[model samples]
Target chain A: MKRNVVSLTIAVLFLTLAVTGVMGFFLPFNILTVSVHALLGFVFIGSIALHLKNNFRQLKNYFTSKTALLVILCVAALVAVILLQPKPVLAILGLSKNLGPAADRFELKDTKMIYNYTPAPHYKMQLNFKGGRAFDAEKPPRVAIWLENTSRYHLKTLYHSKAPDAQQMLPYWHYKKSEYEKYKAESEAAEKAGKKQSEDVDALSSATPNESFDPADYIVPKDPEKETPYRLLIEINAPDDGNEHYPDQPSLVYVVEVDNKHPRSYQVLDLVGYPKSEMDEEEGEIEWSLLYADGTITTAHDLFDSALLLIERSDPIK
Target chain B: MKRHFFVISLLMLISVWVFFAIKAGEEKTSYQSFQGNIFGTRYQVQYHAHEQLDMDAAEIQAQVEKLLQRIDKIASTWKANSEISRYNRAVAKDEFQLSDELREIITLSEQLKTSTGGAFDIHHQGEEIDVSAIAKGYAVDRIAEYLHDELAIQNFLVEIGGEVKARGHNAKAEPWKVAIYIPPSHSHIVGPRVTLSNTSIATSGLYFRENHIKNAETGHAPDHDLLSCSVIHPSNTTADALATALYVMGAEAGLAWADQNEVEAIFIKSDGSIIKSVQAQR
Candidate 1:
């Protein structure tokens, strides 16, 4: 029973060594595998000692014979040859998949990481109104804002009340998307019919607001109970300059404001709106809302729209 | 049996000690490098040293980022709220106040513009001012200085984008070798292989962006006969700016300018021919 137990333990440890030796090729060279292999190797050596002890009498007789001497000599020679030419030996044995330890073989020869990489700077700005005595918490304010470049080129809008009217006023985005779909269908139909595609002039043109009354020009809302009071936040990411920081300056100034009560200028600006098609497909795309200083309000469908609207309404800091 | 076991254990201990000793000795001559992204471009730093670097990886990265952010505040036009952007947007553009760094860049730009005969104009009247051409090179030099002076790194190669600054011997104790590739056209050809030591190389290629190198005279992209131009100098700033300036000057005039100035330049022509400046012939 003692001999059997010793043999079994030795067999299990030798099997572990063989399995792990094979696994060393497929698995990445990490501490876990290396330590396990080394520890198991030490245990396998100890197990061999135990095996020798169990069969000391028979082992002594066997080792003294000519066959044992020849076997030992052959093993030593093979080990020496393998040490000198590991690759060829591995190739012959069909174990040349991972020729060496990964760390030594796959080390970077050219460049080193001196610093951890980071992307370009992204910025955010917010407008918070510590509500004055006359301020209404229920009614959100009307807001419209856009950004311009250094040359006064109209880059984008930071906030727009019209785009954000879906929750409180109307689903203008749905209407806008429907109009785009309608136009696209017509255009495709025209192509199929081999006719020149017609442009939607009416859809492209801005709808004329009531000449008698201007929504943006209206500083005060009629019913305080019906409005949702909120604060405005704007975020913008530095656009890719073909993987470079071009010396081009971003002009961050919002010029148009409705209420004189809270007047402040901001410089961080630029946002792109997700197209209506994408907005419909993706849920939780529109997260934030923009509240104007006046009693008007708008919903920001995404960070891009909010950034655009925020920049559009912001007065340039002098 | 007890004596043999003791002997085997002693041999194993000796073998382990020898292995560790050899490993410790090898660590002295090993090559190490650091890489990161800054100023919208990738930067790689490789150094061969007898000892470990003065700064760890995290410390080095943090310092580089901090330096880049400082430079961005001064020179980046992408940050609308940055000092440079504010300066650009100022109504009082004429005689506007300048930071020390901005003032230095403007002065250098003016000098280069004069030297290159308007071939290196960064600021144009009634147009947006841009210093991207030279700022990257300057940043490269700054990093090299930080590595060499602060970190006590002597043998190092620093590369930002296609701009490279190399000093001392490489890991194999050889001059740093750099290859200039021609802007890929119909035929994929190589420009020149240059050996650099305590020198910088900056290449300007037209294949990446059309009209990126605008002619100050015409206020449009130059219709140059050259596909790419590379300049090597001790100063990264000069190497970077001159490469762009030479590209703008075109093949004939650009080559003539390089020859006259005795500047090392390699111009890859649109016809897939390579031309070397007088100094580059060495």
Candidate 2:
């Protein structure tokens, strides 16, 4: 009886040590998980081997009775795995994931070795090219201060070695300090007043006027300086400004930009209608609306100031 | 007996573990940097800086330097006694005995002139066949090829002036983006993100190198309506030649020529409007 009691105590202690070792690891107060596991494993192996050796006949009968249960459990688990993991079969047929429209993955390539990249920065600018709805066709162009950077800094760090050195870097510009104060009233005057993102990409590297940050927006000009490479971007404004005067609405409009390789004056090359279904065959023409710094408004056929280009992919894909 | 055996085994195991723990602390990676002269310019080359030195970089640089010196010797009109000077004095009299590099430029120039229909040409003026406009592009391509093939560099970017060739993904797997500056004020970018890879992009702008873009057959230098024109091609030399040609031809014929030749291009009209080749837009 004393031997039985000692064995029972030892088995209980062994199980307790195994559970404790598995649950606890690396804490200052419980750092002996590995050591405990090692000792318990040694004890468990010896004790189990001896117990089975003493009960060999009973162990054989127990396994024979549990065979059907073990087989059923394995089959059920296999079925569950098959149902949940249909991707392998779908992929085999090449019919797996069909990411919807605007699901393109952009792949950029380095273009440094082909040019005689002087110890001077090259410019590639992307800007906003805005457009008005069909109800407002006669808005004409504006003498807008477009945003542009002379610095040819890339967004990716991996290409830093290939990028032009600081001596050869281009120039950059940012949005106005009081752009909201200057344009808020004018924007409110529009029939469907909307939020406008700042056009200054330099704003990203520099400190903002306020904590306010939003993407830039532009309306297409009747004539965009054509001799330069300019990109464009557009931001949609909410009607009420949503309690915040310059809220960045969830929606976006259009993007504009020119290639920075050749910087020159601005002109509009082509324009396309919004929403393909509602697109009119106007030969991609746009009337510009000028909202300038001096509060006075006059529209024209072209727009080219500090900014010239912008680029963006369609939603999800972007 | 069992207690003695356990103590002996424990001591042996601890000694082996202590030895391994001490040895692991000594492992580390080594690095090195290299520098040299090539094409009459100095190059500071940095690599993983392993113990194994690359003989190819030194050999290739030497080869390139000699080629440049030879080209300089022949291309200068002032060196009346040299091969290039004599050729410049009377290009019609002699089919010049040229080196392999010079021959490649000559053939490429003629081929581009024929195919892009004058949008890519190296002129034979008076006595010299001037491939000056396209030289940098070719240099970049050749140097890049040497680095990739001979030296086995997988991720590298090389530039010759404004022309550039890039290969391999960025360390972060992002495509390499190039920026181009607007001319007149060549300090600012007309746009910021121009993406390219494994190929070359060259831009010719009115902001630099006056009178180099005159009409070849007529020599009539029209007022440039293009602030800049860039051609993206399989090679830097082709892009360089194409950029010059497109700038001379303007948007109308230049685009048609690009399409017919199947090279990608972007032309910036003097008014700041841009026209991109279908391939580039794609």
- Winner by TM-score: 1
True lDDT of residue A309, candidate 2: 33
lDDT of 2 by residue, B110-139 (tens): 888887677566665543466766776777
The DockQ score of candidate 2 comes to 0.01
Q: Which runs of model 2 end up more than 4 angstroms from their true locations?
A: A1-318, B1-83, B90-95, B124-127, B171-173, B184-189
State how far residue A196 of model 2 sits from its true place (Å): 26
Candidate 2, residue B186: lDDT: 29
TM-score of each: 0.49, 0.39
Which RMSD does model 2 reach against the true structure? 25.7
TM-score of chain A of 1: 0.31
lDDT of 1 by residue, A1-318 (tens): 288987998889888878778777665446676678889899888878888888899989998999998999999998898665454553453332333233121111122101111110111223322222222323332333332222222223334343243223222223333443443454344233211111210000000000111121122212111111112222211221121222321211223222222323442332323222133222325422222322111122211222211212322111
